[model samples]
Target: MPGFLLHLGATVMCSHGGQATPTAPFARVTVSGQPVTTLAAPYVIAGCGMPPPPAGNGPCVTGQWLVGATRVFAGGLPVLLQSSTSICVPTGTPMQVVVTQLRVSGV
Candidate 1:
């Protein structure tokens, strides 16, 4: 690894029982640690903003795995960004993360 890392954006619709909670970043989403926190099926990243083609080349934020499946996709918490994840352009840039409701994913 010596180039770039892509993080795909995903639209997670976490619901408690049957009520839809506010959707936020993957880092702000959780499923009570039940039925396994990870999504059962390999969910294709949806509504992501990952760059298309290659880094510093083609369309950016338009790639298939688009959002880039950043570490946030792994944690699925309403917390802070993983050290591995990019802090957007211009590192050390102050960012705001919102803590949504207890994101419950039933699947």
Candidate 2:
């Protein structure tokens, strides 16, 4: 057995208010098809409602998703623990995003 690292990416829109407005939803990165991290989850919004746009700014845009490194076994080999992050942009009005790439490497 061998150990490897995996990478993933995702894109999502940010939601408005608590009504789940269909604009600017939240983006997330996943592993094995599961939401494990997000940009907005770590931060806190001050207002209850959507905040005003920044002065002299266009539509809001988020930075690319990033994963450092994740340790995973090839078959049943035990490997050192590692970590990684995925990145992507959402599509469509409702937005549908998925992990576009997966890479595995041995440490």
Candidate 3:
């Protein structure tokens, strides 16, 4: 039996308030008709800090969906896992969630 772990890039939302909206619906990390990585249970929003707008003139955006998430598509099915707490995803920054970790036995 063999096992493997792949990372599904989950996009973080940038907005004020709560619930980080997924930038790309969900992070896709599966190739072929085989099960790749699985969404790691319990998502955590790792705040990707942002600096104030340039000279107080740049567009200032606040991140509410703090908790990072990891999602993917398996067997044509969608798997999404979000964090309980929130994390900041400052503007002009790219955020990703480790949606899940899939374990398969290559028998």
TM-score to native of every candidate shown: 0.20, 0.19, 0.23
In model 2, the Cα lDDT at residue 107 comes to 36
What does candidate 2's lDDT look like per residue over 1-107, in tens digits? 23232222232222322111112222243355633332222212221233334532212233232332234332232222122232222211121222222443343
Q: Which 10 consecutive positions of candidate 3 have the poorest summed lDDT?
A: 16-25
Best by TM-score: 3
Q: Is candidate 1 or candidate 2 better by TM-score?
A: 1
Model 3 CA deviation exceeding 4 Å by range:
1-46, 55-77, 81-92, 104-107
Encode model 3's per-residue lDDT on 1-107: one tens digit a residue. 12233233333333321223332332344423322333323223333233346733213233333222233344453343333233343343323333334442221
Ranking by lDDT: 3, 2, 1
- Ordered by TM-score, highest first, the candidates read 3, 1, 2
TM-score of 2: 0.19
How much is the lDDT of residue 22 in candidate 3? 34
What's model 3's TM-score? Answer: 0.23
Error of 2 at 75 (Å): 16
Evaluate all candidate structures by whole-model CA lDDT and list the values in order: 0.23, 0.27, 0.33
